[model samples]
Target: MKYYVGIDIGGMTIKGIVLDPEGKALCEDVAVTGSERGGDAMCDVIAELVNNMLSKCGVKKKDIAIGVGCPGVIDSKNGVLVFSGNLNLRDYPLAARLHERLDVPVSITNDANAAALGEAKFGAGKNYKNRILVTLGTGVGGGIIIDGKLFEGYKSAGAEIGHMVIERHGDVCTCGRRGCFEAYCSATALVRRTRRQMEDNPRSAMWTKYTSETANGKTAFDFYHDDIDAKEVVDWYIKYLACGLANLANIFRPEIIMLGGGVSEQGDNLTVPVQTYVDKELFGGTSYAPVKIVKASLGSKAGAYGAAALVMKD
Candidate 1:
């Protein structure tokens, strides 16, 4: 049976997985990114990890292909990492370097895009032909899948769903853009909004429950039912979130839009309301084409799983 190896490269850690063509993980492990050591050093570390996984599984190097899910502007067509501030990489030919060391074919993609592929193939969107994944973590990250294939835009740099502007001249995003969906929809955005509300309304129950340091994306949802201040914060967040989602739905009209990351842990609290608003504002009525909102099932492993999928057969 053919096997594949997947590497998920992050700022803090690099995760690796060995999987069968069937999408089941044979073995998986993780290691520190050691990003400060430069891209070459990082590739060496990943090669070592990949070798370890093969050794542990008694798999031969010649029998597997490698796929990488990296955080940055990945030129997947040429297997080069254009830029990744988190990894301090610039114009690095990651795939060629790994191929030199491992002697195997390698595929590369943006981490968010990999995660979206992972969910579409093996997680929440498995049943749908077209899907979009929106990860609301420290920042918003996502990808688009059409007919079960990842839709990376020109030069494999597109599918940056988070940067879509939902609010005109609204909050400033780390990307230096104003009113990006990420600026208002990310966990950082939620925490910032929650903290401001807590400070403004000293009598808010959230203050008793959490401090600025303690509050997180869940702060508003956690106290919304009982606290008017918290409720407003949550409502405000949902409004922007729905607007972004509605825009996506109107444009792509995918079968489902999956939500992942820290905030999605709210489950029904998040999906149920977001669905209501999205449906109400969707470009066309829900009768002709409907979209479903769901939570990603693969969690952190989605990137690795999706990376492995890079070489899998359809």
Candidate 2:
């Protein structure tokens, strides 16, 4: 059977997948990116992962098309990573560099864009023509898909809904911007908010779970079904995130919006409240829009699968 390979490149982890031409995953492998070493080290690690996956799958190199899903602003047309904050890379010719080390053709895309492609083609977006994707992790990252294809925009950072300003002088974000959606809705944002509330009262169940002794520690997500403080934080988080969703709904009217990452781990607690906010902010007659909100079906693998899809496109 013909095969394809997809690699999800992140700050600290690299996930590799071997897929049948039909898109079924036949083999999966992973390795640490050890990103502190930066560009040259990342290249070697990726090459080794590809070779390892190929060997284990018993697939010849020439038979497969490969895709690499990478983080940051990417110039997909030229196969360059304009910037990757986590990896501290700028204007790196990743595809060209990898091609020189491997014989097969390699295609590349931004990580968020890949998730949009993966979801639009195979996940909750399968039935939608236009969709918005948000991943609520350390920071909120987003993508826009129109008619089942990722939209990278002319500047390469298009559909970066997380950076959309929600407050003119609100919380500071990692990007040093005030009031970006990411400063309010990301997993880390949730934690920080919850921690601040918890500080006022350490006896709450959420704080008790981790305490000055436990291993796992209290998290922003605990409020979902548990502690009152955590619940308060979650309520506000849903509100902040909903503002972004509402903006998308009123502006683009996508068929659906899919949420991923750790904040999504709250499941219905996260989605149900966000829906409530959307109900309030949506333009009059929004019920007719049919823009449903959903959790991502692909999880972390979406990145790798999306990368693989780059090579799979006819």
Candidate 3:
């Protein structure tokens, strides 16, 4: 029997998993990322994680391949992490270093793209040939899968969907762009909007439970049924979110768009309205190509699961 190793490199923790070709996980473990020590240090920690998983599963290194999901601009073709601000890496030969340590084939891609592939292969998108994952966290990140393969355009840098402008000359994004999808659609954006609404309406029910500094993505949703201000904030958030999803639907038009990350925890409360808006605004209507909006099932393990899928053979 053959096995595969998947590593998800995060700022605080590096998660690793061992899986069979059928996508059944055999073992899982995590290690400190120690990214502040640099890329080489990170590689060592990953190698140790791989070894730990292999040992737990009683699988030989020769019987397995390795794949990594990392946060950064990756040259997937070259197996190099081109840049990662959070990881503090630049032009790092990630796959090569891992290959040297483990003596096996290794592959890598942007973490968001990896999560998309994971969902496509085994999570919400498993039944669809084409799908897109929109993760609403600190920022809006996404991955595209076309015909069951990742579409990492132009040296694996093109799928930075968060940077796509949804509102012209609107709020400024961390990427230095105004009106980007991330500026309006992320959990952070939701929290910001919620806080702004609470500040603007001091008598709002939202302030009964949260202060401007304590407001979060769920604050408005919590008060939506009772408070006018909260309802307006949620409605405003959904409008921008729908705009972004509609833009993606018009361009890629995938069979389904999976929502991931913190805000997605709202589940049907979020998907139902967003679905209605997207269907209404989708190009040429939804009869010919209706897009389904659903929440990603994998949650935090998506990146690692998708990384394992990366090394699985057909």
Candidate 4:
């Protein structure tokens, strides 16, 4: 049977998956990227994991092609990673190198785009012609899939929604830009806001969840179910997030807006509140450009699944 391999590279973990031609999971493996150990070492770890997974599945190297879901500016056509601030990857021919080592065809894509394709082909966006998959993590990551295919525009850095400028003079982003959505709406943003709040009002109940001495180290989202301040921060955060979502919904008018990342796991608390805000602020009367808000069904594995799909077509 024909199979494809998918790899999702993150700051901490590197997950690899194998799927049949129909995209069914045959095997999955994970490795630590060893960020401190550097990129070349991390690639060796990935290769080991891939070889091990194929062996466990009783699949040959020639039976599968590889697709990598990496974090960075990927030139998908040329198989080069132009830049990756988090991973310290730059101008590397990742696909060609991996293909040479593994003795199989290999392709790579941005994690966000891979997740978008995963959703389009097998997850939430499967039934839609146009959809957006937004992931709120340390920073916001986005995947824009139009029609049934992943949109890789102008050298593959096309749909970077988090970097979209919402405010010209807002919060400064990691990319040195001011007012990018990721700077304002990411988990890092929530953490920053929590710290400022703690400094201003250190005796609040919110600080109780962080255990006085440790309050300075944790993020607002670290608040447990009983943490009131955490809820407040999230409420405010969701409101800010809605501003972006509303703007996108009004402009793109997609069938549905799919959210991923740790924040989306909050269930109705996040999605319901954000959707309510959108209902109130959006120009459409809720019927004309009605947008449904849903969480990504594939969760953390979406990127790997999507990358795997790239080779299954072989």
Q: Local distance difference test, per candidate?
A: 0.92, 0.81, 0.92, 0.80
Which candidate order results from sorting by lDDT in descending order?
1, 3, 2, 4
RMSD of each: 0.9, 2.5, 0.9, 2.8
lDDT of 3 by residue, 188-266 (tens): 9999889888888899999889888889999999998999999999999999999999999899999999999999999
lDDT of 2: 0.81
Candidate 2: residue 29 lDDT (0-100): 93
lDDT (tens digit, per residue) of candidate 2 on 173-272: 8888899999988877766776677677777776656553231213646544767766676668778889989998888888899998876766776788
Q: Write the per-residue lDDT of candidate 1 for residues 1-314, one digit (tens) a residue.
A: 39989899999999999997677889999999998998889989999999999999988999999989999999999999999999998999999999999999999999999898888888999999999999999999999998888899889888899999987888888888899999999999999999999889899999887997898888899898999999999999999999999999999999999999999899999999999999999877899899999889999999999998888888
- TM-score of each predicted structure versus truth: 0.98, 0.90, 0.99, 0.89
> What is the per-residue lDDT of model 4 for residues 1-314, given as tens digits with 9 covering 90 to 100?
38889999887899999997777899998898885676677778888989999999988988888889888899999888898887887898888778767888888899889888787778988788788888888889878766666777887868778888777899899889999989878867776777676667666667655643364323565563556666677777887889888877877777788998877776676788889988888785697768878888999999899888766662
Q: In model 1, where is the ten-residue run with the lowest total lDDT?
A: 17-26
In angstroms, what RMSD does candidate 2 have relative to the true structure? 2.5
Clashing pairs in 2: 223-230
Worst 10-residue lDDT window, candidate 4:
211-220
